[model samples]
Target: MKENQHLVHHDATTKTRHGQPSTSPTSIVFNAQPFGGGPGATLTAVMPYLRSRLKSLGPIALHYVGSSLTMDFQKLTETKWDGIHNVDLYTNPEIGKRKLVSLLQHLKPQLVVTAMDELVAAAAQAAGIPVVIIDLLLWFWPSISPNWRQAELVIAAEFYGVQERIISENLNNVATVPPLGPPARTTQDPSADVLLNFGGMINPLMPKQEYIAYSHLIYSAARRAIELRNAALPESQHAKLIVLVASFDVAQGIDPKDPEAARMVLPDEALKLMASSELTFCTAGLGNLYAAGAVANAVLLLPPLHEGHAIQTHLIQKAGVPVDAIEWHELTGRAPIDYYRDSLQVMDNVSKAQSEVIDSPQAQTALVGRMLAAMLRSASAGVSAEDPPLRTLIKEFGQDNGDAMAVQIMDVLEKVR
Candidate 1:
């Protein structure tokens, strides 16, 4: 293993460093989804595992690529990463691909890893770099066709088991791995009555109205559940119900028509609410789910994708964690009140389920370590195992002999940059 050294600048806001850039051992991980919502949360969950795994090898570097919508790249750069590369792919895919390919060529990384996004992985492979694709998003949606079958290794969080199965069934070269849980808890328990968290930006992908309705349903169910529980308890034993909303957008407040909506709480205030909560209600996003689970709180997951509930619900069940899924119809009042009652019953099971699965930090650390190891192995072999055709083509046209090719590549790269 190489000694850890700072290869880039260090500022209070961002610490960018690398061990050394060489094909023998160095790896470059490009995380293309940097919007700080669902994809961002997923990255945060996996980062600790990735860092630990990479540290075992030598020095590792991470570069984030994508448009900065709601997230702050500086937040990620503060970690053990060499640098940040902002690639605007949403505006123009072709130009984005050209620039990304050029960047990979310039970096000459031994391994390249990315989450499940076709364009990014395609670009990396086109540059004659090996690739590892993480299918975290598959847990939320059924498998879709991806063009990059030549990836050296493919991994997915074992949510519903569908992602791994899909990889093996569709892409012979892929491997399935369990997702690392969210970052470990740092503070002592505050213990709230209920915790509510939401993610996915306010866009067509995850509509604002859907979030509003989702929030309303959880708040209504939680309040009702507490009332039912309190009614069964002695007056002295009854406690006030608490609701903590994490990563909610205040700018797009819940609709006034929904009288059942919970009051908005700031991200800073969530700790206090969580400390007070005996139960939690949130979406199935990786960050919020892990945080609640880590703290031993029972969760209610309302994922954004229509088909997501099946896999997410399955994972929660497999973990022996207390979780329940609410359909959109139930959230929007289209479903009967019995649906909400059933969800509340699920939350009622938190304490017993919490004890069954909530172990020490060792389990979490071990899981992360395994994931990182798999990711590193996939990345290191990215170039050689995946892109023989591209490499052969490039070799045929020697760098010094192809002025026209050089001009075309440069033109494409310049436009994207």
Candidate 2:
């Protein structure tokens, strides 16, 4: 994890680790940020990895955001720890005040892990919880991004950017966080399946019928492709595609090895899978983006509904997001049901929810099928001999060898006195 020379600006009165050392094994409560109204992969993926590494210090509590915590996050919280609590954060600060405050008091955390969620930070500070904010994968968010970019102190992924503007703007507070992703990759099987993941954007969408129809469409197209390929080549020589839709346990014909695997995938296992990938088709999320980059040499980034993703990808490309290695396309629509529903029959809700784009399931299926076809074609041919070395990624995210991030966290935490 490299850093810009001007990243950390120390005051005469404060030093990261020079001050009266805080007690060893200081407890912490990680904020389960629910920003942008979505389920948290950070909790399921990033935090667990951090927690395992950080446990040597002291007990850690996980504070989820929302009235109710379910899904993968809840399952993660079920793991034994110092504490496991849910609170209404960001979206409902006032609503969560009492609950959050009580939990902080109970856990007595020296640090409240925050991901540029100022609302949560402010609340924690108010409750006497020292806050350490970090940027998982986004920068230049219209409201939150710019502020974190300017914070007197914060951690960010170096690949996202040098934050050169911030350096020139303030000569101060910053730290470099290595690309947070899966574990290191082992040997990649040449026959490994191509990995396809769209994260939460694909699951628990609406109108079961529409989703099923779309699934059928994708399966038919893939089967057709397979049939044609087998017609020309032996069955053993056909391209293998491993599609992971977290929401759909059973795919029409695109069945994943395990639907629940996304929530429970081990870092080491995840890295190996990605490494074996011939190509990856996934959404632009902080966790998955970096994970995909860690292993896959080739990638196809699908746009999520949020404009924030656009901002993140565009800005990071300046530093070293491997934009040169990535092939960006906008041929398909958004990956949600609200939008996926557009490709379905003309229902009143669909008309009311929609305006211009005919975002029906059929259109999405058609586009996704074509996208899959493109990916499969690439997989069938095999990785290029001259494709730019994945060195850019090696620089951007560092090696996926182990939980080295834990050591980095220790470096920062010991100084949080």
Candidate 3:
């Protein structure tokens, strides 16, 4: 029988890849934009709430299609993912779309969940399957409205200036929700001075050497900044820095003498450390931005690693978030306003914009100085407000939307089941 035929009696005939009788009454295919850590963080936040609701339905088959880098997050350590498809393997867009559709037909999942991936959302829609999209960067997606409208539900993680932007009224499927992030910690750990994070530090647009180069720059700058800060303080009041590593390649290059420099932490563990630390030094990825904003007392942004990071940093700064950042244009002799405008034009090709910045040795050296300066400024300012900028961004973004999206997922599944 042809694979598409399974759709007619999907639940009844659905079997594991091994061809054994299937135990799951419902099946779901999940895909997230494989570029950075944000998608994986979004998925991690929603799963527990989603699985709690699925208990009554017995076992549910889960398959994921995205970059292998996402798996390195170690968030879903306990999840029994039935199949894994590395979307990065299909470098050709047309071929990837066809393969995705074929996978959907063969799996015959009742529903599909995608985060910031237009390809997966569209492919599942073409296969006549229901789709739920978790839109982390709502402010930047106006250009791709038609493509994403194909989804049955689009959950937008809220930010400060979302109301100021014009959204398409024709796209009524959109659901506004709080910034999705790991749960907040009740107790703060004050021992750690800074949590240095570069996010999942891998993207399609840049080569491995560039990533490693940028990573080393950030790592070195953060270390030097901590050394300067600790120099003035008493020996007993010295600060500690911890780096979050998401890739083995990135981890291997970190200083081995400092064990904390390359700790591969799970999502929740990262969040806990972020809360405990006095400051978070990282890139401007929406996932980590919202998370650090939601839980950390203070945040200092490194330069943009890609177009998305640059755009997000611009938006947050414009909204008056008060977070300090090392702007890319400052180092490259370009105007910030001009860079933001150009980034919008080549937003889809994130790596293209990144290549321009990464290829410059002067920019890399200047970035280190900027990173140290921002850290010193943050250290001197100290978080005094009852609501710091990071906390305020989270408060404005609203409460956790994980449970709410899980409810929406259950409703969609009920209709399909």
Question: Per-residue lDDT of 1-417 in model 1, one digit per residue for the tens?
Answer: 343332222112233444355544454655645432445544544554555544545654565555543234235223444555666565667776776666666567766666666777777777777676666555344335454467766665444454556755565654444343322332233232334445443332343454455444334444555565556555654546544332344223543554334344433355345534544555555545544444423344543333243345555567554345554333222322221233334333321222221242442233233323322232233222222111221222121111322232223223332
Q: What's the distance in Å from true for residue 184, model 3?
A: 5.7
Candidate 3 residue-wise lDDT, 164-241, digit = tens: 443544557777777776554333335537789777777755566667767776787677767877776667656777
Clashes per model (N, Cα, C within 3 A): 17, 11, 1
Which candidate order results from sorting by TM-score in descending order? Answer: 3, 2, 1
Superposed model 2: Cα runs more than 4 Å off: 1-26, 35-71, 74-80, 90-92, 143-152, 182-188, 200-233, 239-241, 245-264, 312-369, 386-391, 397-417
Report how far residue 326 has shifted in candidate 2, in Å. Answer: 11
By lDDT, the candidates rank as 3, 2, 1
Best by lDDT: 3
Q: How would you encode candidate 2's per-residue C-alpha lDDT over 341-387 as one tens digit per residue? A: 33223233332323212345555445555555555565565546543
Alpha-carbon RMSD, each predicted model: 17.5, 10.6, 5.4
The segments of candidate 3 whose C-alpha lies over 4 angstroms from its true place after superposition are 1-24, 74-76, 161-169, 182-189, 253-260, 332-334, 341-369, 374-385
Answer with 1 or 3, whichever has the higher lDDT.
Answer: 3
